[model samples]
Target: MKPLLFMILLILFLPWTLRAGDATLVSGTVKSITGHPFPKADVHICDSEDGRPDVSAQVDGKGNFTISTAFRGRAYIVITAPHHRPVGHAIFLYGQPTLAVDAVLETYLSGTHVDSIQIIGDFNRFEFDNGILMTPDQNGLYSASIPSPKKRTRYQIVIYESKGAGPRSDEVRSINGIQYDELEYDSAGDYRSVINTTAPTTTVSFDVSKLPIAQGTGYLKLMDARERDLVATMMSIEKTIYNFQNAFIAAGTGYEEHAKLHDSLNTLLDADVEAYAKQTDDFQRELMTLRMLSYVELSGSLDQQQVGKAIGFATSIPPSSIAWSAYPTALGTLLKASGGNADTRAYLERVATQNMAVDVRPAALYFLVGHAADHHDTLRQVTFFRQLVENHPYNHFTTSARLSYVPRTEIVVGKSLPAFTFPDFEQPKQSITGSSLKGKFVLIDLWATWCGPCVEERDSLLKLYRQFEGPQFQIVSISLDSDPQAVRNFRKNGPEMPWQHVHLPGVWKSPPAELFEVATLPKIIVVNPEGKIIGVTNGLKGAGVDRIVARAMGQ
Candidate 1:
């Protein structure tokens, strides 16, 4: 009986023991683009690049390194080296004891005089000094091995020399075959290198030229070659018109040039859309018409007659058609284009009451609420929000609608200013806090490096500061930039703003911004000598700012 009981216990606990001790072994070799073995490369193995690594290793003379960790499933492998572009890859390590990843490092520098190189990105928060440095070899190539970033992560590289650091470089892909656009460090810049570690959705890439004709044509097996040819020709014309419109907008072409291009494109698009609308009763006709109308609306060059025609065309589409899903968006555009007239408002109200498709109703309600809020119709806004919540309780828009009802604290006269502390951009040790500015009237300028209007407002602010130059008045400018280096570089090269500048690197979500409830750029908040909030406005020049300051100074 004792032997049988022991056997049963071993059988029950054996599975648990195996699971508790499940360790994965990951090993890899590093190589240069020329197939030479890469040595002394820093290797990091982590669940994500943004997060701390579970294990770190350096490649040996033979360009090989290994790490053993309890982490299972998917893993990221990030490698870095001097003079070589940093690259990363994602791999799965489940149901196996070991996984191997061999990767190539690309050379980023072509000329000499570069003493060192480092990478700065979301992984390092874009700090100039706080980055992973690469090790150089006799061949002038650098290498390092570090854990990889999580799947779908983005990052940028920064090259440094004896004078100072160069601007951040573009993101490098793992394959090294194709080149992506350079990463932008500006506030509104949308360039970042992405690491995709999953299987692609489609085996073949979509062809842009064929996209217009192929979309809805998949179901028309009975159509003749002649009919299909006509559809293809119309699609080709639509594509040409769209391409010209996009080019003109991107180039910032003059109004005269723009108007000429717009007329030519609009004529072609209108003719094609009218011909197709008469021929087809299918969803394709509705989709094509909506696309043409959206282009005109986005161009911002539409006349009154054009706007009226787009509205009528949008309303003609049936609610049950798949193409009807985009009608709400088109309607919203027309409503805005018509300058929110009575007719447009009535049409929007009618659409809001109709039993529209699930995918389109939330957008229609959101536009209605926005229009009401823009006009300061608080009651109408609240009613729409309530209707949206009651009708679509589980929709994604419901949460946003509920949050909209939460009243934000407005920074105005007679309220104690919110307290905050931030590192001075020039001197990190000496902090600029709310408590430090007690005896002086402070004009707190919250700005970002990427905001054009914010930079433009600096000159006026400087003039104001010089006008009231004394011990009692001070201007403290706080920068909400993500990278400290970007702020530093801008100060070195950009226009001079002579004032007490503090660098708080969180962009829009920085601590001071959160404390002051700043939602727009060039936000100026004036605090009195006793730390009482006196006034708040989007611009510093106009809107009774001078009056508020003069009163505070007892002028």
Candidate 2:
């Protein structure tokens, strides 16, 4: 099962999903790209990304599935079928019950006999089309064109071969930021073989002379020897980069430990891994570039002059001057106004032009584009977006990047919200719709009774509501709680503030959750009198929310 990554996104953006609304009904259908009816698929309705399903239903023999749900603010629907990857979309159901969404399901493969395998990471998520099979060349060498993402992303690849067995055992070997466990087969039964790479907390320069290659291995061992040390160093560097990134985003204690690990990795750049650096694979060169980038970031936590010294050291080594896939973006963010822009651009462009994989090019462009956009170069931004669309129109992320530059008014925002009608908990006779607030400043708050932060923010929300509760403003609270009883009890016992409240029988896929990208709870959206969004507050303090409400009300 995929890690509950959605849960994390929900927590991060909760302030936008929890909102209360009037009674309304929302209905939708599911279909394929080819207009074929989809059946027996599970449908979900939730308030935010973390919204739980209030109502779940399946299509009949025909491809149509419609269920009633409330539209407090924004909602989303996720659909899944056996042997098919789940797909979801966002919809705004202010109160219109007749909303329709036709979804397409992507096919997923199962079972063994797997051919070429591809991976997705910081560069991109893995897709079926991206995989390539390993083929043995005439020279008795197995080779495959495994591309890496343009971003300084890390990934690991594992190869499983079934041979001589009651079942196919794995001959797992990890590479390119990928990880795997070695599978050994003998009469005794399947067991792990050697632990080839030790987990290093910090990226360390491997001393090639100290490494030993045993004399009694097979042909695979011989080929591995040609690249093993370099591969090991690259993997270690990649791990270090991940550690730094995690530390950068993680909250609370042990931060110093992470910082020390970052510094320790930088120390390896000067330790002389020249033997691996001279290898034919691009692995070592890439590792050096990554090390230099990390060194640059590490310098910032120290003295300011230390950064200059680190850059001077980076400039001394030709390969170290470049940025690895994801490093350019990090470095750009870190060194924006510093004079490192020129060097960073040069390094990024060089990587774009290298024998690097197909996905690697766009990341360089994105970093450069980000820098240019930061400087308000609309032409450059347009050009980059256009390039992305033209070159990678079919790529999943291309459209998202294209949409980023577009003002909300021009695309999915400003338009009248969708209509929704669902039953109230008491009588099952509640209906909600966006049209009810045709000319009011609708304060949409997406929350769940279970979310501690959300519960804490409710008081401030109530205060804000009371302050703005005249003809010009209204508050809509949409609960993402999966249980209906919880929503009713919480509203009754938690806070005495008077406001519109609606609970979608569906949990996370509620029509409102999808509309607003309510990945997090406790989200607050300020809708103008024209039903257009004025601003969105992800985690604003109650005081901050009050200020926004006052400004919206012209107080």
Candidate 3:
């Protein structure tokens, strides 16, 4: 009964299926050039690159094939036959019902067929030798195609000369200050070949003869005074980076050349950022900022004054703009530039706690608490930690915050060392507690691998270990890393913290972080044999570390 109803429905809608807006059906003919022997071609079809379903078929004796699949929207069709070049076509099947793609397989070559020809770009990870091979079929356009899930992608072409010829010894040529060298065909300053998949066109072309190759400086000169415009400056920067990348290929990728190019790129980036500031069109400014602001602001060369200007621009972002639609990473940049200080704290409090237009407080406060301990401001650290935990506990920023606040509020120099027990790093079952070493002068060091200050203080820790690692003087380094394996991994290659190493996961929210009232990492609590807290990280970091340890030992 179901089959009979389906047959009736097909009879009723057969005309519509053959016409427009029906299920996607691709029919094609794979014709081999006359007199060129080739096996039956394999027809490969896929909807998208990201693990989407794919369908395959084979060409019949007459070189005719049809593919019926559930794929809609963008579809990639590839045809490959033995001893012949492969061909791929990109098509949009959203509004179309049935499509016709004819592929002609050719075992022939055109113009001086070099050692190899390949397409390299974001699609192929830009690996020259391993790029997608382009084969000309019956002297058709030399091209390769991949279904782009992205709206568009940029690519360059590479051609290798025969091995006997070796590499070119001299610069091929220079046009408008752009040099295209490295003998083997390098698409250096070529107008970037971008395939915008937004169009429903089936085949994307890369005809080198028609490309505007090596015309960057020439394009800028034509722009003339308009080069000062933000978009124009960004274009200029893009061309400059492209030229630099080609130079890397020409010069053999070296760190020295990379550093020099980075300096040059940074200059152009500064200009682009300056242009962003002066952009008069609000929408264009937002667009430009969205594109290049993150690059410029995080370049680490932006002066405090420049950061001030950027902060103002970020604040001015209209709520409706897509730039403001997502969490403002621009705010995070400003907060990092300011670092943890009175001004940064005030900003977070006003912006987030006060419910200002752009709420940066929740994120900013978490970072402040982490950095506050670096400067040895326990008061400021605790104050903001409490505020973040109490106020924005469920905000995405605070969700990973400390699980619970430490009960012991203050960690003074004269107070009794806070009691605690943690498993040894290597022997997890063996407990290392405050009571384990009753007669020795102990140093309870709280730290994690992710802490920059703790990493810097490693040499100091090693020096103290060497100078006074004895029975009378003991140091137990406790880690607050969330991953126990991370501590083991760090110790594997990093400076070995061999003396009584202990692991206590959850750096910011652990019992150890709370017991010592850790403001920041590399926090060392010095205690006498009597278990009285003698000193903190303050005297145990610089030149004072050895002095305090020797004093603790009473030597």
Provide the TM-score for each candidate, comma-separated.
0.40, 0.35, 0.38
lDDT of each: 0.54, 0.48, 0.52
How many clashes show up per model?
Answer: 19, 89, 1
Per-residue lDDT value at 487 in model 2:
74
Give one digit per residue, the lDDT tens place, for model 3 in 414-532. 88876778887788889888888778888777877655446546656777877887787888888887788767766765665678888765666678776777655567878898988
Model 3 TM-score on a 0 to 1 scale:
0.38
Whichever of 1 and 2 has more lDDT, that candidate is 1
Error of 2 at 352 (Å): 3.5
Which 10 successive residues of model 2 have the least lDDT summed? 185-194
RMSD of each: 18.6, 23.6, 19.4
Task: Write model 2 residue lDDT over 1-555, tens digit each, in one string.
Answer: 122434432332121222233444444455443334443356766543334555567666666666765433334456654323455543434444355555555433222333333332222343223444445445433343333323222333333333345222223322222122332211111111222343322121111122111212111111223233433443455566555444433322334654575556445544434433464655454445455555454333443454454454333333222223223333443334245367756665554444132233455555555556556888877776676566545432353354344444421444555455544444556555667776888887888876545655655676676766788788878888878777776655555547777777556578666666554457787778777777675545577778877887787
Between which residue pairs do clashes occur in model 3? 189-214
Best by TM-score: 1
Question: What local lDDT does model 1 show for residue 5?
Answer: 26
